[model samples]
Target: MQTSKVEIEVDTQRIMGTLASPDTGVPGVLFLHGWAGSQERDLQRAREISALGSVCLTFDMRGHAETLSQQRYVTRGDNLNDALAAYDALAAHPSIDPNSIGVIGSSYGGYLAAILTSLRPVRWLALRVPALYRDADWDVPKFSLDRKDLAEYRSSIVSANDNKALDVSRRFRGDVLIVSSENDDLVPHAAIASYRSAFINARSLTSRIISGADHALSTPESQKAYDSLLLGWFREMILGAR
Candidate 1:
């Protein structure tokens, strides 16, 4: 396998990423980092997944890394567009099998990845402690949203029809893997239950909780648990599909 730096143009500005591809054409896996995180966070995991005979991509979403100045101004919609552009760029890679694509997202990235399934052809989806936001603030800067209100909303029961990402999950036909942190305070168990109930049409749904893990998987043991689950799922969902 070989790795190379890549850039994707999104609305005039450019975000950077790394691409890991095998010598032969293979499935593509795109890794989306959490909010406030740069592409570097997912690089090692991407390389590990790529070794499983796949083309993996890890990119910095706008408002992160080189564009940190825009953090306060970047809205969910802008980040969604970044996800779209990254997906397109990955699908277009010469060594990628566009029809067989997988997406792995953490926290904020997981929310965007859920919506991306509705817009693209994704065969496998993996979300780790995915966050949820109300649709009312479509264009509002993410940072400006009331954390108290957001927390209250997440804690309350929400139906699949009432949430955009959950609604998409209802119609998704591919396989899904949802990883919840055992002690995730930011995304409560209710959030995970909400997602679990929304995947009515998925080909398969696998849900697991990382023992004693926090939302960010801050501890090395927690991180190792997540990596193990992810790689095992890829082996079953991505490699097994072949």
Candidate 2:
């Protein structure tokens, strides 16, 4: 396999991405990181997936890490735009098989992935602890969770929860996977449950909940479990395993 660091221009900004591919030219998988995450943070998982014979491209979301700018992380739509732009860049790459594109997103990225499936020809989607609903119990900073901000967030959450985008997913048609942590504190189980309900009702969807994992799934045991589940799912769905 070969690995390279690349950047694609989106609007006036440049987004950083890492590409890993097998020599045999397999399908491409795009990984979108959550809020404040960087492509480097997902290198381990990207390399692991690449070893399974699929190209993996992971990039930083707007206002995070290498893509960070003066712009604030204010809304989901902005992040979704970044993800779409990255997808366009990957699709245009000479080595990638555009029709076989898959996406895996974590947290905020997971929400964006679900939304993107509605707009793009995403063959497969894997959402890890996705923030499907904005729960009041989550520990958001007071300044960021002010009334005006809260209202905006609530609007976005409601719009998404109402299946406005999932309706689009149903129209586009694709396989869907939802992964959740049973003990996630930051994003409550109820939120993931709501997302699961919405997804299942919208189209064929599979879900798995890690018994003891948290929102980040940062522990060694939890991380390993997530890796195993995700890798196996990607191999089967994107790599054509029986």
Candidate 3:
């Protein structure tokens, strides 16, 4: 196994990531950390996933980590572009097999991953407490969005046609795994149900909720459970595909 640092240039800002590669001609997995989270959160998991005969890339999105200064100025559009760039870079890696790609995201990252499926080729997708946002503020700074309205929007039932992320979920034909926290205050049950209803076309769909877990999986037990669930799903989706 080879682990190394990588830089992805997104316009003027440079995004950083940790890449774990086993060998040549293997599948690739991209890990997108949530808003206010950094790539370090996914590094260990990326390494473990790579151990399963695949290459894994975990990157820090704009407005986080080294780019913390941009937190107040970054928009969803900017982060989406970062995700695209990271995906492209992983696909172009000499050790990766472009035809077999998987993406795993959490919260804000999950939202971005859903949209990415519509724009890229993803054979497998795993989302952890995927979030939903109103399309009215596509260009506004993420931090500036109204929390009250956003909270209300998430609590209400939304159909696939009415939400960008859910809309892509409806069209996605690949394997999907959605992990939700049972006690997540931020992502209500209504939001999860909306996503469940939207994946009408997914090749296969699996949903799991960690008992007594919160949005962050703050407890050690919850964290372990999440890791196990994700790795098991990857074993089925990634290794089984081989």
Question: Among these predicted structures, which one has the highest lDDT?
Answer: 3
- Per-residue lDDT of 138-216 in model 2, one digit per residue for the tens? 3333225455543344333243334554444445456778888887765566556556555544335878999888888
Q: Candidate 3, residue 69: CA error in Å? A: 0.6
Worst 10 residues of 1 by lDDT: 233-242
Better of 1 and 2 by TM-score: 1
lDDT of all the models against the reference? 0.91, 0.71, 0.92
Cand. 1 TM to true fold? 0.98
Residue runs of model 1 more than 4 Å from their true location after superposition: none
Model 3, C-alpha of 128: deviation from truth (Å): 0.2
Better of 1 and 2 by lDDT: 1
Clashing pairs in 2: none
For residue 57, model 2's alpha carbon misses the true position, in angstroms, by: 0.9
Q: Give lDDT: candidate 2, residue 171.
A: 52
- How many pairs of residues in model 3 come into backbone collision? 0
Report residue 233 deviation for candidate 1 (angstroms).
0.4
